[model samples]
Target: MNALGLVVEYNPFHNGHFYHLAESKKETNADVVIAVMSGNFLQRGEPALISKWERTKMALHCGIDLVIELPYAFATQKANTFANGAVSILEALKCQSLCFGSELGEISSFLGANEFLHKSKQQYDELIKKQIKTGVSYPTALTNAFQELTNGKEILDLSLPNNILGFHYVKSIREQQAQMKPFTIQRTSAGYHEQNFVSPTIASATSIRKSIFSNEGDITNYVPSVTFQILNEYKMEKGLLHNWEQYFHLLKYSIMTMTEEDLLTIYEVEEGLENRIKKNILHAQSFQDFMERIKTKRYTWTRLQRLCTHILTKTTKQQMSFINDSQTAPYIRLLGMSSKGQEYLRSIKKQIELPIISKLATFRHPLLELDIKATNTYNMIFEEPLRSKLLKAEYATPPIRL
Candidate 1:
């Protein structure tokens, strides 16, 4: 069976995701659609609005054939690292093509951008470093470097969020020499980070999440029936949607109690950031306030959030350092699967490069350790029996079979 792969964070499996899933399969002409989805936390360094299993059920109900958890080590990293890990998992699954939604919407543009960067890698690196030295954010430096290199030529725009991730996906595929062909579809209606509704039916996940959090507008039209139902069910059962603000006190406590020396050991804590964090922790009122207190031109809010996530989870530099040294994921963690997905897995199981892990107890790895820890930390936001129940579910729940 031919499988098409997607790198996703469903968050709540909104309509935009539904469109992407359908388009990906149609574009690739594949028999099954497989997704490498983030677990508990996201690339932007925020806790998922719901649990990974909840999101997995959302995916399965939305017609996704398979869902594989993108381990904590990669799920919360920068775009390139996130793409690398997701792409590697897809490649390991023997996918025929990997499709992503992007502003550019054209695969050629991503391919060209990757080729250009590969050819001018040293120059681009120097330009990025030069821009960074001037106190600009890393993303700004990247945009400036890309502009300088392209010099008005129509290459992929690195400034757009989806395009940036798309470029990285293409780059990773090339770097790994994977067989999967890369494909892109134009994102419809809403931008990746747009927090306002742009269409009646096709709103960004950001907008969907904001509306859900604020309890303002009805999001029924913005997501599929399954998504709406699952989201409501999750909220009813879990009591609240997960968010940074919900975890702020614990994060504050973590920062307040840890010594500066100890905070420095957390991944991404560098150049006396620990000092800045210590100085700001006492005065901040909320996660937003704390982020504003520490926000600087050099460190993007997203970057800082990832740093905070690391701190909250107590993920040490030593642990992440080991992960960065590896080229590919150590295992493929199956989160959920439809019957078709199971058939595809059975077909590829013998030749797949990584171990296919369905049960947590059956598989062990240094990376899996971080995933478990992240789940534990994520569950901390819940009260009493719910917290213990969620934590127990992590080990006891089997992969969802649709």
Candidate 2:
């Protein structure tokens, strides 16, 4: 069985995602579609609008054949680390190809960019470091360095969000010497961060989430019926959707009680950012306000949010040291699977390099422990029984078999 892999968040399975899934299958012509999805937290460092279980259901209900949890360690990281982890999982699963949606639809550009960067790595690193010294965000520095290196060349645009991720995906595949071929499809309609609906059916996940959060604009056309149903069911059961604003008080409390020295132990808390965060927490009203007060050219809002997520979950530098040492995830965590997915796993199970984890009790690793802590922290937003119920589900809930 040939499997095609996708690195996804599927925050809510929207029309755009549905289109991407379909196109990926068409492009790869693989027997099964596997998704390495973020768990309770996302790459942008925000708590998922719904739990990963719900999102898994959404993925299964859509076209995804198998849904595997991208562990909290990798899920909430920056682009390079996030892509490395996801691509590693796909390779370990013996996928024939990996497909991603990017603004630069052509796959050759990503391959060429990777080759160029590999050949000029030392020069590129020096350029990035020089650019970073100008107080620009790391992402900006990367884009500027790439443009300067390629000067007037039509290489992949590093500035676009999807393109950046695509470049990282290809780079990881090369670095790991994985056999999976990389593919890209042109993104349709909405942009990655577009918060307004630009199409009747195809909208960015950001816009879909914005619509749902504000309780304005109809999202019925933006997502599939199953996604709409699952979303409504989640809200009805949980009473409210998860968001940064909902956890602001808890985050502020976490910051208030911790000393600067204490925060320095948390991953990504460096260069006296702890003091900036501590100083701002006193006067900031909401999560957004705190972010605005603390954000500077050196740190992007997404970067700060990831740091806050680390602080909230108490993910320490020691706990995240595995990332610097290894690009691959230690295990493949199964979240849900369809019948076809089950057959594919059965066929490839013995050949897989990493342990396949289905139950929390059966797996014991610091990374997996962090995933549990993340789930616990995410569930803290709820009241009483629901909170306990969600936490218990982490262990008791088996992988969803469709």
lDDT of 1 by residue, 1-402 (tens): 888999999987888898898888889998999999999999999999989999999999899899999989999998888988999999999998999999988898888888889999999999999999999998999999899988968787888999999999999999999999999999999999999987989999898899988888989999989888888898888788889999999999999999999998999999779999999999999999999999998999999999999999999999988667985788999999999999888888889879888888898898999999999999998889878988998999999999
On residues 178-214, what C-alpha lDDT tens digit does candidate 2 reach at each position?
Answer: 9999999999999999999998789998988898888
Clashing pairs in model 2?
none
RMSD of each: 0.9, 0.7
Instruction: Please give the clash total of every predicted structure, in order.
Output: 0, 0
lDDT of 1: 0.92
Error of 2 at 192 (Å): 0.6
- Regions more than 4 Å wrong, model 1: none
The TM-scores, one per candidate, come to 0.99, 0.99
